[model samples]
Target: MATKVKRARKANFSDRECVKLLDIVDANIGKLTNNNNTLRANAGKKAVWKMAAQELSAMSLVQRDEEDCRKKWRVSSLIGPTVTL
Candidate 1:
């Protein structure tokens, strides 16, 4: 008899979660570009961010806030006005 094997399913991230993941990638990229030595010092983090960015791109979940401002504004319109303290 052949043995049965189960594969683990990948978790799906919501749009908000995707945004947070991209934020982490952007932060790591910023650190790498801010200084020459930072790239070497943060090699592990750089690799992690690079992989994350690629994954996000592949999933078509990465978006720029400025570029998607119109879409965002339209969505926010349904929320009514924001109150400032």
Candidate 2:
């Protein structure tokens, strides 16, 4: 009898591959930071911006309405945080 090991299914990505892929993407997308922590932090921010517009567009009912997205993406609440920057 042969013993078999079960592996979990992933979204076609691996930890080792993820790190290398991140490194490459980060290098191409932005300047490298002085430290690993700073590099990672900045990379996270970049990832958010990269996916947000695309995500909003996809999730939105009005696919052709970029203006609707710009409005919807904002914090419409008066007491909420404003886009000062």
Q: Which window of ten consecutive residues has the lowest lDDT sum in model 2?
A: 62-71
Model 1 clashing-pair count:
0
Task: Write candidate 1's Cα lDDT for 5-84 as tens digits.
Answer: 98954444456544645455455555534555654666764565555545555656443332233233335446742322
lDDT, candidates in the order shown? 0.49, 0.41
Model 2: how large is the Cα RMSD against the reference? 18.2
**Which pairs in model 1 have colliding backbones?**
none
Which ranges in model 1 have alpha carbons more than 4 Å from their true place? 32-85
lDDT for position 3 in model 1:
92
